[model samples]
Target: MGANEALRVAFRTFGCKLNQVETETLAARFEVAGASIVGPDDGADLVVFNTCTVTSKAEQKARREMRLALRRNPDAVAAVTGCYAELDPEALAAVAPRTVVLPGSRKDALGGMAEALVAARLEGLDLLDELRRLAAAASGGLPDPFSFVPGEARFRSRVQLKVQDGCDNRCAYCRVCLARGRSVSLDPDEALRRATSLAAAGVPEIVLTGVNLSQYRSGGVGFPGLLELLVRGVPSAAFRVSSYEPDRADAAFMGAFSLPGVRPHLHLSAQSGSDRVLRAMGRRYGRDDVLRAAEAARSVRDDPFLGADIIVGFPGESDDDFRDTVGLLELMRPAWVHAFTFSPRPGTRAFDMKPRVPERVAVERAAVVQAIADRGKLEFARSRIGKTLVAVVEDGGDEAVLGDARRVFATSAEYLKLEVRGVPAGFHGSCACRVIGLSDGDGSADLVSIFI
Candidate 1:
């Protein structure tokens, strides 16, 4: 890159909403530092990969993508960070050339590094050497993913505010806890301040995200208390809660659902519906506890979009146990479910468990669960045919269209994907939309809605 030319940067994030938030924050920093942001395949001068390690599949995908991105832009500097990088920096460093491994703990250095790179306009071996030297000197510290750099511009319609990070539970099959360590929360006052600022900036929605939201606590405030504070303090911006623990879904926690500002979408970290499977997974709650949480969500809102995460074919999970899981889900009639086959992480207790479910059996069970979940999701979308929802336009402009369809894509407050029409050209931000029809069930299973 020449000194007169601006540095082009690309970002690729793999994993949860938390990782996405971190990527956005880093991109904002780079942008504010005068770096031009481009797509990963746009032949950028720098490519940043914010990776995940929750599943072996995720790590493998990250490695594959990293190699491809590096190959496409061989001279581009690749700065790898996040959980997978934190766990095994050496493995990621070996994936591609001109790579700088900055683990999650030391990610705070990215902003300063971006500023330096823009100022010096370093590239090729010189840029790689500088990044390596900086990475080695960077100390351990987790950056607040929600915090933005000074004068950072807000472009997205919705913001994911990560008020907490890490996990306290030692779930048997979970490697994330080992990578993230104990829970840490942003101070409630600071959280509220940041949320207020975001809402004031015309961000229509704010999703409170964390590794485990149920473990949030700071300045004598629990997760429920923090929710109440944010909901009441920023009534202008709609709120959404990310994946949370079932055990913590107590009366107080459920009360937050009653607030009008809080959207009617809730996803529980219910690993299994079978009590035996739950026990083996080292979960704190049982099957009935999950049911209670679901009931609470239903009681608070009309036809709320309820979701759960299920791990199938865990060690010692018999057919009967799987049946119990199906039964529980059937009773709950969740709007959506994320079903995954058990993945044994190297350091987790479940890795050494006996009488493991065969890989073939696990795959078959996962397929069955996924089929049911897909049907449930389609049914839920169909159920909202005549209902009006608050939706935010995520993509599509006046000139951006698919074939002859001049429509924009949006997401309802309940998290329903919508193929919206009759909105003005270049529409962005929240609007009242009524579900009118369903899209063709060919590939895109989105609900058809129109602006009222």
Candidate 2:
């Protein structure tokens, strides 16, 4: 490829924030390799599809995108990588005959992959083996040094940084551990260095994300120790942690939120609220532990936007179990509920368990749980109606503006209108907004004005 060949490339990512950060890192590598990044419609010479197989739906979506990419650029070299590719290489290869499947481990060697593709050597088995082997060899080396790059993020106002990778938990319903492999924490000094760069880039917020973030430990620095350093070391940007296990929600974790730069929102994964169901799902903690964690967070910060991920209709889940979950939600009244219908993953233990709930029953239970979740969110938002919230101005359009400016807003989609009475001006990017009225629907808010 000539230096001015203008090797246009496009990427589509699916799944969590860690995937996003990895994609960005890949894009950076591509740019360094002299590729011009472009949109999907630009008819790029190369297309990279980052796949996610967290759910059956996610797998289907990834396959659909792969096919679309093939159709969009039939002659263009198509590369597939991510958790889905790592878990099932054959499935990804079947998406397109010309598709080159790259294992997740090979993500760091993407610059070499790009070079091989440009030379049309991305065609045969030998090339694929070489790519895989190169990735395997590189995996043993220390993480390639990375610095946060500044630009307008396509998806959100805030950017996520992967301080660590992989998971140690074997939750019966989760396949992440299998896809990501064993838990491996990034070096603490490198993590802090990256955080400092992100802060320098004027990223207002940086969410620390990973498969099992609580298990992060490097150089005797635990998650909390790293969190303290990030908060104290990089005060220019707000910090947030992604989904965490309930057992990891200890006093030290709670104290991290007390830091001024730390976001008060906490997303704890409480898959079930019944002790029997928890044991069946192989969860480490019981329902009571979840409740206590919620209480502790509330104690630290009044009405913190606490969130939970609840799975309904797991194998052998009974009516009493469902009611117990409802009771727990009623008691804790989390800011929001991420209700998921139990879909048995291929390799998970839950897939083979007996007493499976019917598909219709699972759907019904999910709906019921969602109704309860809706009420909890409404109550949480109502509680903040008269309170002033630090609103991060996400998108300032003609009709509305939104963001996670403070702990008062229950939902990230909770946006305030610019036309509302008593609303102030210049609330375009990460400004505080006073809550005037609740939105008609529970999903958003009605702000009177932006507070300077």
Candidate 3:
């Protein structure tokens, strides 16, 4: 088959921010190949469904979305890709027998789906070599997926670059290493080149993502060093780092955020607050280590939002252990908490760990941490209620909100749900918002009064 510009394509992405970035790359590949990328409901000739398999819930959600995509475009060529597809292709093929299934290991080739569809349209044209060539050129050995910059109109509001991939930190609860292999860090020069391109494309924020971001190393330059160089080179774009382990946060390393372009946010995952739980989970850091890291980051900047991931209920967790977690969170008083109950996946040591926490007990523990989190979140937002911060207008109107550095949800640079109202057109570009009312401890934001 040959290329066709008239083809209408659509993408439905699932899972984390990394999945979203891959989905955008897929859309760009199709658009670059002369396909019109459309919304899921817009009736497509080809539809790509990106799946995630982090949790059982995520896997089930991906399956549901796959079926929905098939229904949405009855005539569209179906394709499934991402972690779920890689981890369980057979189950996926069972549901959608004719669907093109791609796994996370081959994510670099997602762009080829557009070519495959076009080649299918051509009469008697063999495209095996062409498809392989296209995939390799776009990704393959050194996949620069985020470097595909189309235009400002088609540009992603946020550009995500994978400076690192895979994980070697065999945390007892993780299946990512099996699916994504060992870690591989990106070269710094290439990373800088990609960030420059995204900035040139008018991407406002660039999120540096990885399965194990702290593990990034290339040519004697560590993740922090690479970040320093990128900040100096790509000053046009603000940079953000995804979830990292607290052990990697050191004085000199955390000091890199002093660069003006690096967003003053550190999303470090402290799986459990108890040292016992941390050892059982095989995580390298302890409660004190995480606290020290948080303190270091906060000390470097003006109240940079320090968010964390905490697993509430793990195997063999005691009441004191849970309380220990709450105590740590109270001490850190983080801007946000990504708290969830521990999930047991097969092929992990934790799967066979003794004395599993009962589902009911786990749920209750999650609630306890959640309440702690809610209070901390609200207080964090209220902390900035009077300070004027540079608010980047993400959208406008009743639901319109603004973001700033720290990049949580930021106008406070937090994920605080503050509803915006009466933002005049003059408030459009280069605007500043004074911290005003915060949400009422619910997901809904407070009624935005004015642009103080």
Candidate 4:
């Protein structure tokens, strides 16, 4: 195609941080290939939907977005990729007949796909070979799923960097193992280079995301080493680690928070509070171990934003087991709880487990766990009522400005009409805001004013 006729592309991402990183990488590839990247509403010549299928709801959402994308740009060459595409390509194809379905492992081939689409438009003959050659030349013996080129993400403030890919765990309720193969880390030098560029771009935060981040091991260095290099090396930006397994929460891993730029937040997955349910689910950590990990993280950083994942109403869970989970939540009082009702995945071991919990019971258990989370969050917010927190001002709506507090509440929509304390320097975009009073309805605080 002529320079003026170069394709325009848009990407829509769903699911976890890994998907976000991959979406950024995909956008970079299109930019490098001379495609004009546009926002989802701009209606590009090519629309790429990066999907997730972690839960049934996620799958439905992905499908809904795919349909919407196709409707938005009916003439565009639609492409579907990521976990959802890998798991069910036919489903995606059915939704968008003209859509090109790319597998997760083959996502690196997007650049080649874009090239082919462009060349076919120009030559009006078969150009697949030319596109394939270009991709092979660019890869240069890197793995099939090549690491994304380091670049400033289109969204500048917060960048999701994929330090690792894939998973090796055999969790009974997870199909990630089938969707994404064994674990592998990105080259440490490449990661550092990307982080440096992000810092240079004035991005204040970079989150290290992966299928299983704890399994990061590259070039004779572990996750801790990579974190130390990033935290110490790139002093300009704050770094955050995404979800981690409890077994991976060792002293060295937790110690990275002591570094200047590392944020005090840890999201550990504790599927069940009952020991019996944990064993049945094939999770490594029990109730005690979960509490111990939480305590260890807190010990390193006082009042760190501790978070946990809780799956309620798994098969064979008794009422006492549910109560045990509530007891643990009360005792540990984590900053937040991601409550998910147990759903039997098609290929998972839990699918065939006997004495399955009824759907209604699972829903009720989820509500109970959610109540516990709400109570804990309120308590955490109340504890910080009179303190001043460094808030990263994100969205300034008509009623209030929203940002995360230091301790528990990450994003607060508290009204702005409260008494004035003082607005701190650089308070417009990001600043320190003093907490005056807690919102009576939700746990969000009524900001006294921005601290000067």
Candidate 5:
């Protein structure tokens, strides 16, 4: 690619909402530096893979996608980054030809290097070699994990405002903490400023995200305090928390739900509900903590959509331990349960633990959890059959279709998927939706709404 020619860049992101936010930020920078952001299969000159290494499967998927992207565009150069690259750069670097690995810590500099590469007008293997050399040099030092790079590219309806990075906890099964290092938070003032700016720019909603959102602290401001600041500062925009840890869902944290404009949806990082399993996993909180968090959220918000992440078949987990997890789920009845089979990652404490759970057993437990989750979702959807709720239009137009029919897809404040109809020609904002019925195909609540 020459300086005069705009580089066609495609991005494939994996893992948390934090990674998605970072990918959007990178795409904005590339667009500013005279590059066209294209789809993964659109045949681009450069492709960026924002990978995840939370589990072996995530890393495997990253590798597979990287090779597929390269195959789709035979002459494309690849730029890999995120937790996977941070933990195993060499593995990603060797995945395919004409690829360079940029670790998570030094991700902010990737755009600058790409700009320089574009200006250099080098192509083929030469460009990839130079990018690799630059990545090696940039990997020498640690970076400010909470570094902010401003951009105006609003790719999605809800903008993700990342206020924190890294983690302080040493959860036995997690490899992300090792890759991201210690906790680092963005300044509260800066966070507020960014939120206000996004709201002013006509962005309807902003999602606060971080690797460990509950661990956020800066200048005597905690996550709840920062949340209050943004809610008060930007009255025009809605706010959502990406995910939070169960132990940190204290009184103060729950109080944020009472604030105006705060969305009534919460996804907790409740790895397991079994006290014994939680203890073995090095989690500080017990099963009661998760219950209390759920209770607190319900007490504050009106039928809030409570979601959680639960790991099945962890090291040394017994039948009783698994029962405890299911019992907790029965009590909470979370709208969404992200049931995951424990994949022991290398470099984590759980990797070498003895008496490993059989893969077949793990899969069975996951299926059980998933069944309960699906039932909970259906029950929740049924309960809202005749209620009117606030929803944000995610995808809709005159020609928008849902499974062969025309419909507008929206997400309610309680995080329910709504297929709405009978609105304006191109409705795309927050509105009051009346749940009419449920769709037979996907079970998404059918609704009717108009732009507010």
Candidate 6:
């Protein structure tokens, strides 16, 4: 690797849509530095894995990806960053010894390090050793994350627009707030500029994502205000927002649906339905609050795709508490639930809380919630049948028709997976299709062209 010779860099992201968008931002920066971004499957001179640590399983996956990157390309300079690095830098550093570990605190400086690493390799210096030393030398609390702008023409349809970063809520079971810091939103003007650029580049959809998406606040404009600006500035793009606490949602926020560009989907987090458990977990809202938010959202949009995150086994939770959670899900009838078994992270308030649920018990409780979730997903998918949905096609399949149908993969405005047929390949732009039925495959929806 030398200044004259272009370097190949590959990225593997494992977390939220925000992480994915950040990876794209990093890739764009690498390209600006004269590096070619390649897939992880391909051999590359350097690889980066943006990791997650919301759960033990997520951390395990991040460590595994770091190790796999090294195994796939033994000579590759591997770097790990994101939540896992921010939460547990030592663990990630120990995972792939000699690899560069950049904590979320130092992520902004990463763009400048790409060329430095390449230059070191060319100088016959040990790149990994030098990078790891540099990682250690850069210490102290990280400032607010640098504003990242995803490439204008990054995807065919959906482009994730990160309008916010960090969180303020210190929920007992969450380490994200400690790792991510206070909420800081993107500037509305800069956000609108990015949105307009994406629309001009032919992006059909833009997914607004962040650690605390609904908590976005910058220049006296909140998430809803920012959304209105994006919608008005980019008429060509449809927008979908990722998850936030249920109480963060209200009529004012959901009312943005009046704009056709704002998609009808709310990935809300209702950690636990039991008021006692919620109180213990330091959650700001109760079960009823979640229900009201859902109702208010529905009032704005007839039937939006409502999904939630439900943590099952927090400390001091009794059977009645667990039952209350399940009951609430049954009553709310959300489109789906992201069921996560409690993983006690060190330094979190809940870590030392008494009467911790046994691991086996927590696993069983998670299964119960997931069963309800599975049924909810099926019912939601079935609802799409016989209705026309405006959707954008993804390019996972070749442009060829099978029989009388073209099995084009797509996603509806509400973030539902769709297998669209009868739409021409040349029709690469967004299109309206009538959902014919559900595929046997999980999360699969079948759609046909509405027009002859």
| Index of the highest-lDDT prediction | 1
Leading candidate by TM-score: 1
lDDT of each: 0.84, 0.72, 0.71, 0.72, 0.83, 0.80
What's the residue-level lDDT of 386 in candidate 6? 91
TM-score of each: 0.95, 0.84, 0.86, 0.83, 0.94, 0.92
lDDT accuracy of residue 235 in candidate 6: 84
What is the alpha-carbon lDDT for the whole of candidate 1? 0.84
TM-score of 2: 0.84
Q: Higher lDDT: candidate 3 or 6? A: 6
Off by over 4 Å in 4: 1-6, 32-36, 39-42, 115-146, 153-155, 395-430, 437-451
Candidate 5 per-residue lDDT over residues 1-452, each given as its tens digit: 44455678899999988888788888887777667889989878889999999989999999999999999998888999999999999999899968888888788777667576665443324566677777878877668655544445553566788899999999999999998888999999999888888877777888888898899999999999999888988899999998988889988988876786799999988888898899889999999999999989999987788999999999888889889999999999899999999999999899999789999999999999999998898888888887887887775454734433346778888888887776565556777877877766555444344333
Provide the global lDDT of candidate 6 against the true structure.
0.80
Worst 10 residues of 4 by lDDT: 406-415
Candidate 3 clashes between residue pairs 3 or more apart in a chain or in different chains: 1-119, 409-414, 409-415, 410-413, 410-414
Candidate 5 minimal-lDDT segment of 10 residues: 443-452
Look at candidate 2 and give me any clashing residue pairs.
Answer: 390-405, 390-406, 391-405, 392-405, 393-430, 423-448, 423-449, 424-449, 424-450
Residue 108 displacement (Å), model 3: 1.6
Candidate 4 per-residue lDDT, tens place, 1-452, comes to 33336667889999877777777877877776667789776867678888887788888898888788778777666777788777888888788665667766667667556656565545544333444354345444334553665453354445678888888788888877778888988888888888888887766677888888889999998898899999888998788887788877888887785665777778888878888889988988789988888888888876777778999878888899998898888877877799998877778898888788888998999998898887776676676677766554442333323333212222222212223333322333334557776555542434334443
lDDT of 6 by residue, 100-158 (tens): 77887677667656666666655667767767766766655355464577782255577
Q: What are the clashing pairs of model 6?
A: none
Give the runs in model 2 whose Cα sits over 4 Å from its true position. 1-4, 111-157, 395-429, 439-451
